[model samples]
Target: MAIVLFALPLAVVVQRLYHDETVTGLERDATRIAAVVPDDLIQRPRPLKRPAGLPSRLTVGVYRVDGRRVTGQGPGRSALAVRGRDGRVHDGAEHGRLAVAAPVPSDEGVAAIVRVSAPYDPTGDRIQRALLAMAGLALAAVACASLLARYLARRLARPLERLTAAAQRLGAGNFSVRAPRSGVREADEAGIALEATARRLGTILERERAFSADVSHQLRTPLTGLLLGLESALERPGADLSAAIGTALDRGHRLQVIIDELLDLARDTEPARRHLDVPAELEEITLRWHGPLAAQGRRLVLDIQHPLPAVSTSPAALSQIMDVLLGNALQHGRGEVTVQAADVGGGIAIDVGDQGPGIAEDAPDIFARRSAHPSAPRGTGRDAGQAGTRTAAAAGHGIGLALARSLAEAEGGRLILRSSGPTVFTLFLPDTSMAS
Candidate 1:
């Protein structure tokens, strides 16, 4: 647009200037012709000596006042004489061609006129040539600029295009995909950041998959054992049918508890918290697990501090935590397993401990996902063969105890391994019964 604006008007001005200069030269030639012409020849038919090198295109005419050409013969000599005062050149047309006419002065004032003319084409040719040159230069410059701009834009846009494609793949669950870095500083930085995010997302998804596998394994083991135990008890001749069925039902209830705990762990939301009677809830849970532990020859002692302080926690979350602790106690624990409740300052404490050998020095990282040793008893062991009750989840210490601790913390409580000798796991929750 700018090229057009500047070039077109400039072409017009150059053409006009060239035409005006031609007119100026014609006027000067006309004045000289008038000065040399004799007065006697002006009123009568006469001719002057035409110069030897006279321009072929220049047309000069000396005309009488009545408009008759008398002096020199030229192209379009039939133009009328224009009378002008002083040396002023009067612009007029000679036939159809452009010409300059001026008065030839005599003692009596104006008597005849001298005119000069040339075809206007040569001046137009010069101007057109000059304008064409300017236009060519301008177009070349614009072409160069456009090429440079395209190159620079591709440099910047290529990296962004790769990033966009990688993002799409990642959103489609292809976390292994990565964006390659462009040499441009800004694009390289973005690629680096995007690659990091993909790695983090892949790691998180891997852990979740592993967690799911662990949960499935933990749940299926006990259910299998319970089925086996039920089949064995029912197969025996003269077995008490009611007792065997009752035991199978108890095992089914324990299996259900394991599922419930896993479900709670799977929930993305925090556990619900409210004022709960800690002692009453613990008492109920102990009784629920007492049957399976007794079947395994372990005594359960519920030692509750009278008038226990009410703790702020969800009953479901607290019950699951206790189940985890009690399950841990029953697997590797021996003798009497105790569910002891006490009121500490501003909180309630429940200690589920066992008189078993406890975590051995050899059982390091007892809370890891899998036990270090095959026979090593870790918190929340996965063996359900001992008792198909609340203590069902076995060895991986990874799922149950971790899930229990997570639930406790979510409900504004804490669960910790308080002692190794008695293998005591203590749960502390803030008392909120008096809170408004």
Candidate 2:
């Protein structure tokens, strides 16, 4: 486009210059012929016509000293005057005549004006031909430029297109699409970066998968023994022992719940995503938990916005996140718990707010293994002196918030602590695509 823009005007100017030079040359030859004519011819005006050595197309006219026409011949009766000064041609146009006037030297005090005229039609024709030639050249230049632009666009776009495809594949959990290297240095650099990212991601995913499997394997034996022991205790033969056994069984059950949560978290690295209506899902969860909330003397409020878009997420993962949020509320809250859902641009968003003792300022540290917050209730004597042991045993359970965040991220979403007051904790889940 840049080249065409300059070339077009340049061609037009060149064409005009060539035509002007041609017309000036023709006028100069006519002036020279008029100069050689004898002085006697100027005083007595007659048809002293020259032979055919000059161009037959040329037209000539002679005028007396008083500007009266002497001889006129050609397409038009009127002729243009040619003025000569230092052997240079000067042109003038008047009275339907395009003129080049020159002075003819004479012994008589009166000098003669030699004028030449050609019909404007021939000059117009030459200009039209010149324009036509320029148009053709412009057309040819445009064709070549178009081809070049297309070739350049293709060369630049091909690598970017491959990168797009590779990104889509990565999004689909296929991390094996390597971009083909081609084109310039910048393109090669981008390809190399993509390949490196894929390799690192593949390695990280493989490690996570292996770690999950190993954790499941290592915990199987202890989990089984704990379950069996609780069952045997429940079947004990004495009333007092049975009561003790029941208390032990309750503790064992809590441990079992913790282990189950861990297994779910480990397996939740990859989640099945599906579109779910936000209002409907929230209603169902609220219904299921209504009895429990009422039993605890807490009011559950639904402040859902209708017509929310369906969110792409894993149902199980979403449920687990909600469970952790609600469970934390129930365990710690003293008043109302509110659940709300709404549309936030590209996807649906859900927030669960509880009138509980809100997250401690140091809550983030709880995500680390064995890091205990001062706010957590201390265990009784039976579990005392067991802080280190219990910390190790319950290591996986305290990561509920962390698990919620991880599960949300796996489904291309985020779990955030929106706001925390003295007695409020709000958990907000927003789809990643919506934020983007």
Candidate 3:
């Protein structure tokens, strides 16, 4: 549309300019012929000599003041010749041709007139040719602009298209899909934002699944123990019913604690850290695990080095981690299970070690979710039989240490296997004073 608007006016200007140039040439020729006229031509009414090198398309004539033409190939009576009698020049269309007249000057006011006329076809043809050239150039500009517009549109749209597809897949729960990159900055930034959203959604979903599994595994022991104690009390003749009820209540309370801690671990946001007294914390864990270990003829020992610094961590997280370690030792270790806490520079270090045939050299990744503990004894849990123990190596150890390690990292701490022979696992927490 813009091109047409510009080209239409430009075409008109070209046509007018060409026509005007032709008329200007005629006026120049007429003035030249008038200048060289013999002074007695108006009185004699004879032929005037045509100018040298006059254009063939142009016709020249000498006319009287009353519009009578004497010499020229044009109408005998010319209106333009009569109009030029007042010592002025005039130009207009005359008999389908362009004509211009210049008056001759004499001592007496007005004399003869010189007229030049030409057919309009040549001027019209040149104007038409010029307009055609302009139209062709306009069309070429339109074509180039169209191609450039298409290229720009696709460059801006392709990245958004990819992001749309990725978002659709993500909405459908395919969290693995990623957005593509384009060179455009705005589109690339949008794609990056979409990718970050996908990652967060994926992490939240994974944590939810882990939360469900964690609840089941962590609650299994206490729940089973509660049920088994109640069953035993019913089976025994004249059993202490009140004592059995009290034991069941304790086990139920423990289940609640496990649930609360698991919920804390499963949240998308990190919990606030608190200063923990290492020895005091371990003392409570030992009290809880002591009876369970004693029932299996094993002792739980808590040893602490003096002047232990306060470590920063979530209290529930710390408790759960200790519970997992103690539970593991109870189910699979021999002799004594010792929890040793000491002041290590820049941090506090705690080691949970057991006297048992440690993890096998071949089974290096015991903390992996799918890896079965090679040193786990036969028929470890309540529901396991001899046959179950035979295949226990194939039944992966649940996400106990893995959950513990994750919880520790959330508190900005580290958990690692410091030894294999004695099966000592070390947990290091940054000292709260040092952190400050």
Candidate 4:
């Protein structure tokens, strides 16, 4: 549109200038012919001699005052000839041609007229050709502009398209998706920002998934205790309903505490750290598991080797760690469960050991998030059975130990497997003598 707007006026001005120039040239030729005309030509009235060097398209005529053409070429009786005798130059269209007339001066102030005219067809054709050239140039400019615009649009649009796709994938829970780069600076920056956002969102969502697994694993034990109490009450004849209800309520309260602690963990907030009575905490945990262990024809033994120093950690966190270990032992171990607390290296160490076939020595990283120890060789005594247990723990058992280890570490401690045989998992709390 802009090209057309600019070219239209330019073409019009060019055409008008060319047309004026042509008429001016005709006027000039007429003046020159009139200057050479004899002042007595009006009286002589014979055919005038033709001039040299005039354009072939022009017709020159010398006419009497009465409008009779007595010249080389033109109409026999010309209206322009009669008008030209007024002793002035005149120009107008006559008989489909541009005609100009100039007067010859005599003592009587006006004499014969010299007229020059050119056919309109040639100048009209040239004007049309000029307009066609202008139109062609404008169309060429428009085509080039369109192609360049398309190239620019695609250059910017393709990356935006990929970024949009990446965003959609992110929305659809595909956080690992990445956006491709575009060379444009602004577009590249947007891509970089989007990728960074995806990574952060990926990490956030992963933490959420991990939190969910942790919650389910952590809550399973208390839920089991609650269900066991309710089932035992149902199975017993003439059971004391109030006492059973009281026990179930207690279990529910403990479950709620565990949930609060898990929420604190999920939010990445630090639960208040205080001096903990390791012996007392273990005693409570043992009591909670005693019924379930007894129902399986097993016993849970808690042994405090000596007077233990208070450890600094979140009490609920410690309870959760112990629950995971006890749960692991109950599900996989054979003989009685032994939980022993002792003072070791100024920090407290609590070992939960069982006699079931121990974890395989060749087990892959057990603390890794949801890592399945898939390749341990099968055999007896630290072979197929323990490997299967480890695989079960990794695969269907969810991330109980992994979450336990994380909770221990969050309280400035660590949990590890001290022995593959007899499967003793130890929880070590850093010494709290100074904090106390």
Q: Each model's C-alpha lDDT? A: 0.71, 0.59, 0.78, 0.77
What tens-digit string does per-residue lDDT give for candidate 3 at 1-436? 9997899899888888988898889888888888998888766766666768998878888888899988767898999999998899999999999999999998987788888999999898898888888888988998999999999999888888898999999999988887777889998888888888988899988878876766666665566566667777787789998987886776677677777777877875675666777778889878877776766678888999998887777788888888777777766667899999888898889899999987777874767665343433333322322111111112344577777787788788988989888788898988878768
Off by over 4 Å in 1: 1-74, 77-122, 161-193, 229-233, 236-291, 294-323, 335-352, 371-391, 396-418, 425-436
Per-residue lDDT for 1-436 in model 2, tens only? Answer: 6656876687678666755765686677666767676677655767857545766665676665455666655332333332342234556555544556666765544366666654556666776787787678778888998899999889999988888888888878887878888766798788788888888788668646743643443233234444444444455555355554565565466456545655655554554545666677677667655655666678889888776755666565666577666655655565888887777766666777777667677555533333224333433332221111111222233445554566676666777667666333333455544545
Which is superior by TM-score, 3 or 4? 3
Model 3's number of clashes is: 0
Per-model TM values vs. the true structure = 0.58, 0.47, 0.70, 0.57
Q: Output the lDDT of residue 58, model 3.
A: 86
Rank by TM-score (best first): 3, 1, 4, 2
Write the residue-wise lDDT of candidate 4 on 213-317 in tens digits. Answer: 778655544565466666767777898879878867866776787788778777765656677877778888788777656656788898998878778888878
Where does the lowest 10-residue lDDT sum fall in candidate 3? 384-393
**How many Å off is the CA of 215 in candidate 4?**
2.2
lDDT of 1 by residue, 14-85 (tens): 887887888888888778788877777764667676555657798877776655676776543344463444
Q: Alpha carbon lDDT of residue 27, candidate 4?
A: 86
Q: Which whole-number lDDT from 0 to 100 does residue 31 have in model 3?
A: 87
Error of 4 at 237 (Å): 7.6
Among all candidates shown, the one with the greatest TM-score: 3
The positional error of residue 309 in candidate 4, measured at the CA in angstroms, is 24
RMSD to true structure for each model, in Å: 7.9, 16.1, 6.3, 10.0
Better of 1 and 3 by TM-score: 3
Better of 1 and 2 by TM-score: 1
